[model samples]
Target: MNEALTLISFGENGWGDEIAKGVIVTVTLALATLPFGLILGFIIALAKKSQEPSLRMAANIYTTIFRGLPELLTLFLVYFGVQIGLQQLLKLMGFDVYIEVNSFVAGMVALALVFSSYASEAFLSAFRGIPQGQYEGGYALGLSHAKTMRLIVLPQLIRLALPALGNLWLILLKETSLVSVIGLSDLVRQSGIAARVTKEPFLFFGIACLIYLVLAIISSSGLSSIERWSKRGDATR
Candidate 1:
């Protein structure tokens, strides 16, 4: 018991600080990516539902390419490929600037792209599920397109998309583990380091598993609350 306690202690000898910092990084990456992902997803969903054939086709291609690629490959493309491309562009422009894409930024861009692709389908479905009458009625009532969307359509769209978005959020949380491959020092990487140094593979890996499970549980609880809140107004109607 003492040995296990010592392993998780916060002092210089323990890996507690490193593990805690890793958890923070993992959470930060997810949070930072989420809003941008959702916004891009909303735009893609709108594009897919647009009257223009070209817009629909473009959105389709965007979703198909990102969703079909492996998440790790996307990360590699963003981290290594993008950095190389940027440096080359700078050289071509006669600027001697060497641009470095940090792991956090790369992870954010890659994951956000993936999330937007997947979430676009959910948003498209929600948008289509909304009745055409609502659009007509809003216009009939002198509501501008922007005001109609904000006051009427947005609520229903969010309500319809909540469950799918919650599932996506859970998936996104787990997928953050992949960022460790690009040297983000996230939870899995920190655990691997501790295990390697202490030669306690099972112990450290087990701790990592427990940490992930705890995070999942907490996220699930929060999502459940959001889902319930989202439905409350509709339930009364």
Candidate 2:
């Protein structure tokens, strides 16, 4: 037990600092991805709910393509394929420069796309649950379409979609591990490196698992609070 403790101690003899940094990266990546994912998802949901057939078709195609692709494959395409395409484009423009995609950027973009795809469905469902009278009520007060959505529709939309979005957030948190595949040095990669160097796979992996469980537990608690807060004045229980 002493040896194990020393192995993970926060010094030259241990990998505790590296693991800590990895946790930071994982958390930071998730935080950075959330707003973009949520906003894009909300936009996509609105597009799908639009009366225009072209807008609806485009939104549906976007969600279907991203949702159908495996996360890792999407990451690979963003990191490798996009980079190559950019490089080629630059070459065609006579700028002969190599454009390397940042792993963090690639991972965030891929994960955000995936998260938004799923989130749009949740938002769409929430939109459907809302009555048409909600829109009429907003307009009855002389609110513009955008203002009506921003002030009235949005609050209710968020309240209804909070639970589903919370679940997606948890999934997104776990999926941050997938970024390690592209050399992001996230929790999973850090743990993997420590395991190999120390020849204590179970120990390091177990620690990783514990860290993830703690995150999930904390997230669940926070999400529950948010859900309760959103439902606070509801007459429909």
Q: Which is the leading candidate under TM-score? A: 2
Cα lDDT of model 2 by residue, 1-237, tens digit = 999999889989999999999999999999999999999999999999999999999999999999999999999999999899998998999999878899999999999999999999999999998999999999999999999999988989999999999999999999999999999999999999999999999999999999999999999999999889988878883
Strongest candidate by lDDT: 2
Residue pairs that clash (backbone atoms under 3 angstroms), model 2: none
**Model 2, runs deviating above 4 Å:** none
Residue 218, model 2: lDDT of 95
Q: Where does candidate 1 stray beyond 4 Å?
A: none
Q: Which ten residues in a row have the lowest lDDT in candidate 2?
A: 228-237
